[model samples]
Target: MSQENLELLGQSIAPGESRTVDFSMAKLYTTTKVEIPIIIERALEPGPTVLLTAGIHGDEINGVEIVRQLIARKMNKPKAGTVISIPILNIFGFLNAERAFPDGRDLNRSFPGTKTGSLASRVAYHFTKEILPKADYCMDFHTGGASRFNAAQVRIVAGDKQLLELAKVFQAPFTVYSGNIRKSFRSTCEKLGVPILLYEGGKSLESHKQIVKTGVDGVCRVLDSLGMLQDQFVKPPLTESGVLIEKSRWVRAQRSGLLHVKIKCNKLVQKGEFLATITDPYGTMRFKVLAPNDGYIINVNHAPIVHQGDAIFHISTQAGSI
Candidate 1:
């Protein structure tokens, strides 16, 4: 039998249907309404409901691009299940080109919020209560905060074999073991028993082609594993099951100066490998930043200049091929 009609935001959409629901909340100072577009697609056959979301950080344009491509290419139209894509969750921050809500709160850190909380908290409360409960599986996209460009990877809390297997199926370049932060979306998903794979790539405000492709391809692999990918798309080939980073640490700059990086994000480096150089703008003194240990360069700082203690590189302390 076909799946029951999906209900969201007080609207009912039956099987083999497509709908776009506008989630409206607080308006701008000018009283203009801002709506978050939630696109839903369902198949004739019954299967799992997968939720795809991006732009939670607002400045993470690469994540936004990834979801946008999935919709534009018709990838969200599943074969046997339902797909709901929310390309930009924090429309307020996206509109202002800021990282946090207008009230200066990170929407991600305000999950399961109070009914009368701040604007960000209210958005979180409604989403956690209304929308999140309907999802069988969830995928959230993100990027490095500012100048740090992260390698394409799926992050999951360690020790969950189910989530680990799902990450393997997504097949990003790396599978990172990260603990869920309190009040964060990943933690909320865990609390609600919804499996989530959090993807991080590139950096905020910049959309890289390769990073977007990796994200889109990873989504395809995950959907195909669940038997939800459309027939028009081919299943992605399996590569390395993806490297597992058990532990990681940042390589910090020892001196403040103009920075020049020499290695790519996913490259493996030796302990003493020359990774980058921090030099005085006037060419007086220079300091070489070497790898702290032998591991993959999973994140690189793309800033033109750095402070004495700024993190310049994220190197894996312990990693093994899965």
Candidate 2:
């Protein structure tokens, strides 16, 4: 169960060896080393390598929990290839319990970065240069920003038959067609020819049990398909692929007031159905929000107050079966 000369980030890793590599790039203001621990597990038989990551946005605790559960359950110990789990990629952001880097930059937006760039960009630079090249596929966990709660879903760009197939295999609740942002990690992975499946679930700063379970189960299914899943773990039964969301739009609050949601996320609603109510502080004014069309409610705003133009829900305008 050992292969010779498997080098990663200038360190030699023998096959079947489990190692935790502390990636040190910079130091804090107190001169403390900022180390990002990368947990790796390799199998004796050579096959594809999969990289699993979370915490690009520090406040998205559900994503972090999903990756944590995978490691705690020993799911990363692959049977054929290697599994690399970086549970907290943005250590700086995580320490502060903030979404962005200490410098106010979103780490997810810094990709294929430069050595002399901002802190986030520099971290991205080293990761892109040293670690990402080894991954044949990648799964990056994420969640809805702030108080927006998203249904467990996998986001993939349109027209890539291969990635779409993998998304189906993962079997999250939904598979959404989304365009990659410029300079985002998903974009960089595409440029490097590495297929990536981005998962979104729950809301920031919270860990939902159902979300974590969905994510962990999806990863197992993907590994099993790749022949990397271990024999000890029971292979998960294939479920219907996530509902393919071809097009979706945000349903904004029509008036500024204290909002009350009447339905939960992932619920199917008919057109003109009551979704929420907005009321004024004086108790003199009330406004009812209705579904614009028949679609699934994929996201919901958990915040109690909303402005006139704030987005309160994400409804799929078009959906199809795989």
* Worst ten in a row by lDDT for model 1: 234-243
lDDT of each: 0.93, 0.93
Q: Taking the candidates one at a time, how many backbone clashes does each contain?
A: 0, 0
lDDT of 2 at 286: 93
Model 1 clashing residue pairs (backbone): none
lDDT against true structure, model 2 = 0.93
Instruction: Tell me each candidate's TM-score.
Output: 0.98, 0.97
Please identify model 2 stretches exceeding 4 Å from their true place: 1-4
Clashing pairs in 2: none
What candidate 1 gets wrong by more than 4 Å, as runs, is: none
Cα TM-score of candidate 2: 0.97
lDDT of 1 by residue, 1-322 (tens): 2499998999999999999999998888889998999999999999999999998888889989999999999999999989999999999889987889999999999997878999999999999988999899999999999899999989999999999999888889999999999999999999999999999999999989999999999999999999999888998788766899989999999999999999989999999999999999898988999998999999999999999999999999999986
TM-score: model 1 vs. ground truth: 0.98
